[model samples]
Target: MYSVVILANGLFPSTEKPLELLSQADKVVCCDGAAAKLLMWGREPDLIVGDMDSLSDSLKKRYSNIIKKCDGQEDNDLSKAFRSCLDYHPSSIHILGATGIREDHTLANVSLLAEYTELLKDIDCTVDIMTDSGVFYSGFESMQSYECKEGAEVSIFAFDNTLKMTCEGLKYQTDHVIFDSLWKASLNMAKSSKFVLKLNHPAKVIVFICND
Candidate 1:
């Protein structure tokens, strides 16, 4: 079973209502004081992980199974949790509460996505971060959108070189077009209520270089 990981938010936003679907996860992990937020939501955090900075004493006492303590200022609790993931080897990792804070810290957390490729090696892995700007990630050809509104927008750039794209139903469709290797990613609009993108040629390619 995969584990849903929640990172300590320097600042929690009011718009995020992720708990509405929290029950879908097989297990829950709190990266530091983020455990308190889950506790406040009437949800029991399976594990309270990370250094004990923001995590209160009570939280530590209540859930000790996942309450892993790693003291370090060089990295945030999110980083610690990623390292700790190796021990459990969760099949899937869903990250919530990983947005808003010091711009640098937020950048650091986003940059952590790259370091995780080592963990993602030879495994199907993805990271989800909820933010006002919206969700982002790479990998996974068939993305099942849980909540993309009629007018809500999302943009995906090829991580490395441009991909040979065959968009199914976008406002501007591409039919086996070779997108550039080192160029801007084309902004495609959704045409049908739901859409899927399948890369043409090289059906078995993984790990792309992205500079967007």
Candidate 2:
């Protein structure tokens, strides 16, 4: 089962999808201000992690037992919440509300997914960011494949300084190419039911399947 983490950003998908995810989550963690959103939706988080700057005083008093404060200013609330989830040793993690509102924050949050993936590599824990537009998966130093309908839109980018990759089953196939810029692999489409990517080093890959 997956552990769900909700960030403070206000870019969650429709209510139905998040509720569905909550229902299936083995544990739910809220990052600081996100607790207020969960409370508004009539759900109590299993744990709340952050610097306590965004959490209201009343809510803090009310949910004191579940609140775990991480006052490190170096990392954002999302990173704090992620560290807290390590205690539960979840099989995988699904992130919500990580985008939207502030474009700078959105990019920063999305960029951190690769670093988080590298941190969890030894434990074999997968991390994904879920948004209304699509889902982003983080992969490192391995071969990975995804199942998607033919003609689906897919994008892959390098998170590190450089990414060495080879792929098949995409509209524009790549054979052992090194990508240095994020835009190098954008706007690709799936050519078959499945697509495969072989990575020579740690990297971040994002696939966007048409919601329709």
CA lDDT for candidate 1:
0.56
Mark the 10 consecutive residues where model 2 has the least summed lDDT. 203-212
Q: Over the stretch 1-212, how does candidate 1's per-residue lDDT look in tens digits? A: 66555545555534434443355666676788877887776778776667777777776777766678888678778878776665666766756666676777666665566556445767665555544445544443333232244433444444333456555545665554444432243454554455555664422222211111
* Among all candidates shown, the one with the greatest TM-score: 2
lDDT of 2: 0.77
Task: Report model 2's TM-score to 2 decimal places.
Answer: 0.88
* Candidate 2 per-residue lDDT over residues 53-164, each given as its tens digit: 8889999999899999998779998988888898988888888888888888888887888788878978967787877767777666578788877888888877444566
Pairs with backbone N, CA or C atoms under 3 Å apart (clashes), candidate 1:
159-209, 159-210, 160-209, 160-210
Clashes of each: 4, 0
TM-score on alpha carbons, each prediction: 0.63, 0.88
C-alpha RMSD for every candidate? 6.3, 2.3
Which stretches of model 1 miss by more than 4 angstroms?
10-17, 131-133, 140-152, 157-188, 192-212
